[model samples]
Target: MNMIDPWGSSIIDYDKLTEQFGIKPFTDVVDDIPHASKLMTRGIIFGQRDYNKITDALNNNKPFATMTGMMPSGKMHIGHKMVVDQLKWYQEKNADIYVSIADMEAYAARGISKEKSRELALNEYITNYIALGLDVTRDNFHLYLQSENDDVKNLAYIIGKKVTFNQMRSIYGFNNSTNIAHIYTPLLQVADILHPQLKKYGGPKPVIVPVGPDQDPHIRLTRDLASKFNEEYGFIEPSATFHRFMTGLTGEKMSSSKPKSAIYLTDSLKDAVKKVKSAKTGGRESLKEQKELGGMPDKCSIYELLVYHLIDDDKKLEEIRSKCLSGEILCGNCKGCASELITDMFEELDQKREEARKIANTLLK
Candidate 1:
């Protein structure tokens, strides 16, 4: 029962999507991919399609690529951080990393100017990407905007011929209200996913797309295209791993437009702390009631913060969860602790972001 839209974000029920959509659970292939990420181990990366190809490539010592696109409509937030964290993992494994700035998408979807989109892509998103530990110096690493990439544009035209409006409508839930360019953006995205397999990029190798489940429609389409493109399925269907979304402070969807709902990486230390304090929790109405009835960590945004971003160690996260469920940790105290953890992370990232700024031109195309 997950509601997914590439143009919009929603809180997804990961388990429901897995059952209904036939997306294999990560645990099914965990032992196959060496050095599986904590996200994979902890169910943050809950689902996958053709991830076995990546494991095959790794074990065979064959080259593989990883690509993820960013729409530069707002400041990079914790939700976006999750993707970059996965990118770092792939980079460490020596996967050729390709990051795309979806400027054309921001324009069609949000009516953002190309100039503004480009600015946000570099100054905001890419900076945070490097700050979060993505390896940009590698020879195979490439960062480019959809508008400036001729190879992707050309590939989109080729891929578009293989798809029809009927298919788009079915997969994307599009109709009369959708703009023509918006409808066409999916082909561009399919090209983004498939182009890494093109002869120039490194012919027909496996590629991994680490994303939130909201973007799976694009993956579904691209995978379908990969099989149909050639007699031998010349392009490898790009594999995908899905993560759950981080909810807003008030328990709504974490949206860039709703500043109070998310903690942006660019947020000042004081503001980030305030956001943590204001976040929603699923505890009882009163501290006394919490102790009597125990807390609902399953429904708390604070707990999600630890699971998705703030905390790293499994033992530490379990300890926090146990304390909450036993009513030994209350909302006020939990918020304070989360605030400190978030503050420290942001302070370090903000500084690294400054360092990242120095290499913007070096990375951007």
Candidate 2:
């Protein structure tokens, strides 16, 4: 299987899938097939967690909790969808899921007005999540906002007492010039992880957190704090992870701050088309150049998008790659197809999201 780093450089070892801080894929997910091996490895890193914890929870028929949260920054983007997909996967695996619309974090981090944050958090953000097929009616999933609860505040206080300024600096790049306020951000995130059970349910079952790799530092810090809490309190299962990262339209980082860099779920079809059409391509500088030098399918942002989200069928992806390398496909036309597909996707998702809002309102209420 072909594996590439974030820079699009080839990765040599599949065993890196089972790192100390990552998920360990099952052998069946990795054996023989090269493409599946690559995805299995991706899934492991993306679903960052200890393999044993997952097995133990499932074996004991325990209702292990899984979590993923998003701050109400703006509309839900495709970058966010990647995490949502992982959450759906965990739900399929019978995880008692907890999703938080972190309005408090948004307030603390962005200093937005409470009304605006609430609008984005409740109507826009939470509505979009259910639109993306999150099944909250199962009763196992808990959907709540962080700002509404005092338990999280208490947990944040306890976690803050345990974590040192030095450790926060190391993880968050805080230094002498850094405000002490930024140092407390990690504790708030930790509170998000443990708040569900503290409020609604508590048990010894394992916990899993599904998030983008950018959130890895938070999980690592939470894991460390949870261990310390276990040693001190004699309870609480350390949260394991399922790690993953999404490729941007620029072949780099995906951020909502860079609107063109990500496809938001709320984007109009025209907006989706425009963004995809203007996306960075890994093709040659010009048609002449592309024809003479054949494009770098391996490094193209468009191709990576297909690999990451669009092309669900692995075999079809291989064919597209083969055609691209053989100069049988044009980058512009391929992107045009991708643009239409994404625009269509957003249209359908928007409809489902409207439906999900009604359901979420009734069920959550």
Every model's TM-score: 0.96, 0.82
Q: Tens digits of per-residue lDDT for model 2 on 1-365?
A: 22222212232233454463354454532333222333354343434355466655655666677877767767767766666666776787778888776666666667765667667766776677678787777878877766665777778998788888877766666669755555666687788786655534664456777654446567778778777787554436555544444556766666677676788777788877887888887787778777767678877778777776676777887888887776778798779778867866777787787787777566434
lDDT of each: 0.86, 0.66
On lDDT, the candidate that comes out on top is 1
Looking at candidate 1, what is the lDDT of residue 6?
A: 76
The number of clashing residue pairs in model 2 is: 11
Total backbone collisions for each predicted model: 0, 11
Q: What RMSD does each model have against the real structure?
A: 1.6, 5.4
- Per-residue lDDT of model 1, residues 1-365, tens digit only: 53467776666777788887788988889988888888888887888988999999888888999999988888778888888888888888888999888988888888988889888888888878888888788897889989999999998988788788888888888899999989989888999988888888768898999988878889888888899995643887789988878878889888888898999888989999988998999899988999988899888999899888888899998998899999988988789889989988988997788789777756654
Candidate 1: worst-modelled 10 consecutive residues by lDDT: 1-10
